[model samples]
Target: MMPAEQAGAAALLRHLAGAEPIETHVSAVFVGPDTAFKLKKAVALGFLDFSTLAARERFLRRELEINQPAAPALYRDVVPVTRAPDGRLALGGEREVVDWVLRMAPVPPEDFLDAVAARGGLDGSVLDAIADAAFALHAALPPVPGLDAPAELGRVLAGNRQAALAAGLPPARVAALAAAAEATLARLAPLLAARAAAGRVRRCHGDLHLGNLCLLEGRVTPFDALEFDEALATIDTGYDLAFLLMDLDHRVGRAAANRVLNRYVARSGDAGLTAALPVWLSMRALIRAHVLSRAKGPGSGLPYLARAEAMLAPPPPRLVAVGGLQGTGKSRLARGLAPGIGAAPGALVLRSDEIRKRQAGCAPEQRLPAAAYTPEASMAVFRELTDLAAEALHGGHAVIADAAFLRPEERAAIEAARGGAPFTGFWLEAPPEVLRARVAARRGDASDADVAVLAAAAARDPGPITWQRVDAATDPLPAVRNALGLNPDDPC
Candidate 1:
């Protein structure tokens, strides 16, 4: 469209939004009381082009087409902003199609996850919601064949390095990060190709971040998928989720990121993707650094650069297990110490209760039959836990095993799995009355232990134990800090 046409369309949209138009690098968003009108800016940015009227219409149609499955309720339509017969303008008017606008159900400003995080309102439910949304989005879509993801990912990484270099970031750091990325990508090339070959690549929400997610009707759903380029949007499913994990680690805390990761892995059963996650996370943060560098110049990129380095720097892997009676707070201590351990976001927590439920083909909160807890079934759960821990540990990630290891052999299985890694075990203890009270207070936790289970555990002799004990009547952070050798005043 011409300048006059674009200017007129923007003016009409602003009138409807009843406020100043929100501008980004590519588009202007006008939010009304209940609706939002977005018009792409007319500029050729090399990677994307909305410079021509036809290109704008094409992208608008593509946005509507691709975002339907992911967020059909919020993405309303691709309507044209037309000039009226008079000097006025309106949406979808009888006048010629002067320009196009993407109309959507307006998500409230406060409903975005970033906004919620700023308000200190982000919770585990929000993480679960995000995992569910991403899993559902990927589950239904079949992968697109012939996606040269290795090459494309390489180009994107290289572009990030070039952009950072052009913006005058620390050259040594940029080169080191770039070299690390190349090495990771080299090692992961086969897996990437296999994922694409196995049809794990699909049309994805390219921009999966906190800012792009909103609590639509109290559920988190991703909006604004990659619409400008098919190659960029067609990606490995887990790779798409890395952006979200990266955002959580950077914007929220590492623990929040780990919470989301564990939830998504359990829900999606995509634990095999952990091998490549470091690369994806580092690459994502580097790209973010480049964006900040190019947009704000110099100092703005420092924090993001540090975050990228942190993603690549794997802390020494350790195997830490929390075991005790039903209400001894094993799970709480495990979670408390998880994010403080090795690797990007933290440890891979493999809860024995969840493993047992999975083995029984039940949900985490569902109870299995009494027979399902037999010695044979118990060994199977332990084997699964050991295997998962071994895989995570070998991949340079810390492991947190949460379970009631009342039996001496159950404890031995974890020890056997650790191999050469440093091993630490904590037994959380509380009074029997306190344990009963804790059991009574349980809601939707994975542990199905009740008073009877606690009494059974008390009845059993697990032989001589060597692990340390933690008092479990209060928060477990202090004990965890002492175990990890962090000062009491050290900020997490």
Candidate 2:
């Protein structure tokens, strides 16, 4: 070994010999042997404290307790340091206790996802393993109480907005951003409440990035979870997954992010999460922006801030109205097109079915009573949908409005919201028989329409539209790609 490496080994030995291990280590962490010990810093942050030895011991115990479930084999135990009669430091089994350190069997740094990605050795299988492991972990977490859900979510959102404003962001832009966040939360409040009632809010890893994950023995393992703040770690599962999504977005991995989301959702059977993803993703972006903004100046977060700004920068907004009768795959096409147009984390998809269901106090598959679909209710849904799309677009997001916009006035409302922005009007069309078959095949959906409804929509005159027809016979993603004038082979 070189002089520095030899010096590092000596320092490690000295620290190991001490009764109370020192927190500071001058040596490189990864260069050391397979086994590593970590000591808590004797400092106190607002959400965490290790100022006292007892506090550090408490947190160490908590870390072991929390991590053992997900990574039982890796987390060895929290062992106390003790002094010998001869005034020599030793680990455990001594007469008198001095301090405590969390002991663990360390894995190689090469096992990390970032390291693999850097070496161009990452593959879809690795990503799949990660998604599967994360999904399983999420499923195992205990749900938080319903009453605390809204307040906790509100605090997170408000804190981010306040931080941006405090960081010297333009007042108008800050207010606009705050309004956008508030509006999205308000729109999804009911859905969030329902999910909370269904126990979707759970104790989770608050910071889930590739760097926190590793491939151990061909299985993905996540470590270094948020051990300090239960309030931060306990959140809606979507929020937990959003961190990874935001991380992928920052790395310019849009397709991979979507694939992870799709795969996780499929495995977990959490379709309701789809409706909640945009809200969580937006919150994640804003949180990252806030963290970055705070990192400005010497010995601060400048480097991280620059990266966050790039990730949080708003995308050019486009309004794409999906016009078709029920079961023509409007929603599918809109989802497919969203990631392709807007910035990876900035795309805003506004779905009429989801909005209507939220307005009607029911799940998507629940049939809307005749009273719920009154002219006034329908008008309210349309107004809300357009309002959301316009707000999202103005906030630098691509908006896809999915609805059966059979009436010219409905189409006009959407067009007026575009406000000279580049727009695409996708008119998904299928034969009457195909539409009926598609609607019938759907097990659970918000649309109450049937064959008659499709027949009536087809009979109605669709006024002049600058729209492209999507053949239902083929995959809608390819048709959307072609309509957007993008390469069909584009991985997005």
Candidate 3:
């Protein structure tokens, strides 16, 4: 082992042998059999360094100060490592101080989200709790200005490109990768500026994978925030969340990722932050690839590079609408179809009901008065719907607009907005009696329309709608599959 490794091992042994300890992949943790102490390795990386004793002490203090708010139960204090008169290492001894380490309270490994995920048991409740905790952390963290946000991300992408090149990647492949990174940065510059102005940039847990979160005594806790540099940790809040989002995506849990993101947005009420998610997720995946490229371990950079490429792959822009009367399951089918439609995870779902409510300046669950449902208001809603769909599709997203296209003009507007891209319209239909019964049984819904409204909508002429009709009584998945031209058995 090199000197740093030897010192790390010695520090681990000193801490572990002094108490009943838990061994992890990187750190040998001592649990006081109750208190936990983490010692930094005397190593230097481009972004962080613990090269000197003083540097280590400084960062150790910072770790405690920064993490205490988020993980108050875990970050106990920062303590000095001193040498005894007999030249033995001891924590906070009376002799001259040799080093310092972060002291925390050891929590059970089963409390960690990774452990839960490993056990094949991550539920909405756990995900919601995690999202809430992360939102609180982001809200509490102080902002750091003048960070090299884009340049740092570009460096990561450039490093990945160089690694792919060093491994004999094709020139065209490398060029394409560079171009994608540059284009993404250019596109996101305005959004980044807006986010910074909104105070969304903050010093956060630079590394917020599932492994960094735990359930301590039935409460969620986050630990081990980046303490070396404010610039590394101080980033857009979307970037902070993207770490976990990308991790979930890598695990093939895109649905879970969506659930987490939606829950975070709902809790934080920061829907505008989503405009930056694609850039942040791309950056996070690139950083992961860069780190893996430097690893000498079993699973190296090859798989991560492939994942990065997949993450950075540009999706074909298309607008598909799931249109039907109320209670015809448009939203349900749209939700089911979105992940598999070749768009990034959490692709935009623009529901006409939500858009209509927004146009009326009310909440989704609030009822629109009679005047708010006038023909003029309806036209305005349709116009806004088409506008949003066009914008999202133009921005390289596959969109599913859930609405009741009862009017010929409304349907025509959507078709016209497709703008030369292949547009598939899914029309869900149910028997009149069945539709009436379904609408009557619905509860806690936003739509003011009842069976009478459904009857009116059904009688209206849906003229020249280029759509595939799906039977609402049967499994909508088959029709959805056929509409998207995918195998029904393939798991999205």
Candidate 4:
């Protein structure tokens, strides 16, 4: 239902757009033939007050300012709805101002990522692009000044608890989840402080879910960043990313979530983010739960509440390494296994190809020169892989090291990187001709391996293969899952 105070502005927008508006609690977006106009509701929610003309105009302009950089094509100038001398509400005129509207380019309903996911269209390419888009946004955002990570997180948790209770969710469950989250914050305080000091705290898109992303200029672009509160928008990058991750896990699947996560970490090289992921993921889920409870009653949010609790108590961390010669489906198997391994969205995949690309300061799909693959360079990649794996493992998240662990030392180092966590090694095997064909068919992959590279690797004798070998000529995922004691149909 439209608010009484916004009727005139809403009527003006309706007449201009010749369409009904898509409404949220705080704003309504009216899409016309060529452009869209966003109007703030004149309601004073405790967290934000858009009750007055000045306040609504201020936030409309702020929305324009915050969203233009990320989605320049979507956000346009802010215009006023004016009351002319003739007592007509017009879009823009040099007259008495009544309300403000942010003009933007219209996005098709189908272009939004949430709509895409609804049709099961979030394939690997889209997921990778989404991660890249998120990484780009985070990289562009400047670090926040004087952010107290622990205190900010604690305040958010407290607010979530209060909102949950007020929304009539089971008090016992809400209290328990809040207690768990507070303890997690207490445990991670030092690390969060260090991360803030290291500039990991940035003014990010506070609400980074699928609904806010759209296809723009043939690229997956993020839009509608939180503009009402600077404190909410300023947060640790991992927490900022958690909203998207949590949304993916709920709406799409864990595999999609895991892929985006690994891709984001691969691009940003922020593996330490995994340390705080559980609480971050839980907090995101809790936010959704309470919001849903308030909107649709408590029962609508039980699933999200359950998800929040589950995220806090994920299975213990473990290490899984998938190693084989070129084109043996090592990465494929690793990806297949990761979502079922540990935690809500599963294990962190550290691929040597992506790592090498990171070291060379290039995109994963870009081909690197042969000079970049020297033995020293290769060793450095392995070292970084182990280091990242160790960090994620210590943080109680599973790690999947996806590389051609052809050398004895490389295999041993990965095993030791587990750091007291259980380790499983799977060495994929396939015929030489099959590997050659597969390598030849590859396109746009992170791996730069070719038939010649495979031949060279085949020439070197990688000593004693004791790891479980899976025939890669057919589907190897079933065997890998069986060995890992995971049901083939498990959804993590």
- Give all TM-scores, in the order shown: 0.91, 0.62, 0.74, 0.98
Q: Is candidate 1 or candidate 4 better by TM-score?
A: 4
Tens digits of per-residue lDDT, candidate 2, 1-492, equal 213313332344446544223333211222235555766655664546776768878888988888888887777887776667886656678567666667776677788887876776656567667777888899888787755666678788787677766665555755666676677677768777887888989889888888878877667898878888888888888889988876765563676676566446435545456555555776776666655555552224333334433444444567788888887888777657666666544245667766777676554457876687777888998898777666555545566778988778898898888865788888887777888898778765557877777777788787776677777655777757776776655446
Every candidate's lDDT: 0.82, 0.68, 0.71, 0.93
Worst 10 residues of 3 by lDDT: 1-10
Predict model 2's lDDT versus the native: 0.68
Candidate 1 global TM-score? 0.91
lDDT of each residue in 412-453, candidate 4, tens digit only? 999999999999999999999999999999999999999999
Give me the candidate number with maximum lDDT.
4
Residue-level error in angstroms, candidate 4, position 282: 0.9
Task: For candidate 4, report its TM-score.
Answer: 0.98
Best-fitting candidate, scored by TM-score: 4
RMSD of 3: 5.3
What's the lDDT for residue 316 in model 1? Answer: 72
lDDT (Cα, tens digit) per residue for candidate 3, span 1-492: 224533643565455647644543333456555767776666776556776888878888888888898877788887777776786776775687776767787777687888888886678678767777888888787666665566665665676566556544445755775687678877877766767767778877989988888888788788878778765677788888989888876763776676566556544545555555665676676566656655553246546556555666656767787888888888767667666664456556677776777666565567877788888888887887787677656556666677898777778888887776678888888888878888899765557888888888888777765688889975587667785786665335
Task: Give the distance in Å from residue 424's predicted Cα in candidate 1 to where it truly belongs.
Answer: 1.8
Model 2: number of backbone collisions: 1
The residue pairs that clash in candidate 1, if any, are: none
